[model samples]
Target: MSPNYKFQGWMGLDKDAAKGKMVWQEYTPKPFEETDIDIQITHCGICGSDLHVLRSGWSASLYPVCVGHEIVGVAVRVGSKAEGGIRVGDRVGVGAQSSSCLKPDCEQCSGGAENYCQNHQTGTYSSKYPDGSKSYGGYADYWRGPSHFVFKIPDALPSDVAAPMLCAGITAFSPLKRLGAGPGKRVGIVGVGGLGHFGILAAKALEVDKLVALSRTSSKKADALEMGATDFIATDEDEDWAAKHANSLDIIICTVDSPKMPLAKYLRLLRVGGTFVQVGAPEDRLPPFNILPLLAKDLKIAGSSVGSPAEIREMLDLFAKKGVHTWNNNVPLKDANKAILDMDAGKARYRFVLVNEKHVSQVERNEARENKL
Candidate 1:
């Protein structure tokens, strides 16, 4: 049966949309297929990538885009060909990735590295389907995408709390779990913002011996410590911060989005043969730095995007078991403009999840519009 409700959400018409200029209205979603599942979204976490897409920072975004990838809601519709054992009434989630070429010959997908799928990987929003249909995001009351990317949320985790983990949580969790961040390891998380906070939580949950939160200043020292950090470092405030913590960590997860920060200094925090994984992306190209630390200390610098679906599932169970509370607040979907402006101003204590409080029929929506007029 077709949905009785219409698809409607906030849309950014131009580059100025990032400046709180998005308009609320109805928009077309991708056509449904047997492998697709429709979600009546209850919560969507606002990510830094949302702002980048809204302002065309990453690249020129297709106009009238809806930008949110950390999605959580109930499965209102499930296609017959859909996988993941999802049912219409099941609570579920979708991350940054919506589709990947799952050909048997596709080494990335077959090898469980779908995030690095070289063929036909589609983003949840601001991307195109293989059929050339425009893909939208979760900044709406409903979301429709391929079932391969939809995951069932664990019964123990709340939807609001589980939302960010799909994206930010996995982004941090993957490198740590993959690179061995647990017991006997001394882990360092760079930047205590959205992604960094999750990194600290994940590393702590993984039972790292020493979990240090590195940032530019002491403003977030109290917050980081409360998030299970064993120590905190203000790189800019302490003159000898780099030397003070030199060769102390076994692995470092860099989550700061800006490249202008201290790259060379961060590399110095790593011990001999340590691995540094950068999970954040800077808007502009990164500046040059000396490779002296890499040569002399045998340090390795790497990068990571969002994680694969399997990694996301693992992260969910870990967070649920550990009772990891994401430091965040909620905003009504109607005030998305103000929310975007506030997010740009760095006002979020940690992260913001947009709440879709109503899923009314079109007639009811029209009646409410008339009443407002």
Candidate 2:
């Protein structure tokens, strides 16, 4: 399973690299194994985590890091022992996770919660395999990783649109589904950025009774409504916004990471026995909030990480069935540095997907055939 192609990508050499200074260079990938697959990357979605890692926000990032997780491409090589029926030329994707301890005796792995397998969890980038080789990501010409973490992209989903779903879509989908967001539930999605946009779409696809898009201002009101939100709340415009929407929603998924966000007011928006799940990762600690609301209203506040492999498959199937369209702005792969800067500045309409023109002809051909059908 030796890689025939040289591993090359846009790498962040240091903290300053976050300021649109990534350089194109060749790098070595992890040692290939029978369970691995090599992907000729075509599209990679720019995620907030990429920026966080580049600037060493979460922690010290592995130097010369290639930071991208929501990746889609054509499989150029598939190991004989690779699971999931992956084959050469098949369009596939990799998410935030690359590997975990899948040993049968491990509780998380055996219980279908591999993403939470703390025993040996490895991120797609800035992580090390058990063999001590550094893992690279998909802001590059090719990606090499374990096939178990790779997924076959559905024909109904285009590469550019499908890229963000691996992280943003699933980040929103997992919590909504876990909290039972359907028919009778009123769901509120806080923040209308890349992650929150998918939250609205996922809740809508689940057929929740009401979908509320909450933002600091009304700038994204129209866009949210177009994405199936039943209502929009402008917190900044209304001084009594929280009071106005008090006890209105059964579940709220907070996608904003501001430490100073009005936590108490957000909790007040939930009905009795409601649940609030925080998915955004803030570098600073969340401001302390009163717990009286939780005790009085029987409210539950929690956090969710990315979805498991099984959950990802379920989300893809749901997207295919419901014709869910991701609001994406596609940028050429060479312009990734600029794209990251734009994303950091909140310029993306929803999500920023990097398209590698060299490998996108296959995707174009597929799109053309699907269009004719």
Tell me, by lDDT, which candidate is best: 2
Model 2 Cα lDDT, one tens digit per residue, 193-279: 999999999999999999999999999999999999999999889999999999999999999999889889999999999999999
- The lDDT values for all models are 0.90, 0.94
Candidate 2 local lDDT, residue 33: 89
Deviation from native of the Cα of residue 280 in model 2, angstroms: 0.5
TM-score of 2: 0.97
Report the C-alpha lDDT of model 1 over 1-373, residue by residue, as the tens digit.
5688778888888999999999888988889999999998888999999999999998999888999999998888999999999998688999999999988999999988899999988999999999999989988989999998999998788888889889999999999999998889999999898899999999999999999999988999999999999999998889999998889999999998675878888888899999989888778876577988799988898999899888988889899999998888899888889998998898887989998877423334655887999
Clashes of 2: 0
Instruction: Flag clash pairs in model 1.
Output: none
Question: Residue 349 CA error for candidate 2 (Å)?
Answer: 0.6
Clashing pairs in 2: none
> How does each model score on TM-score?
0.95, 0.97
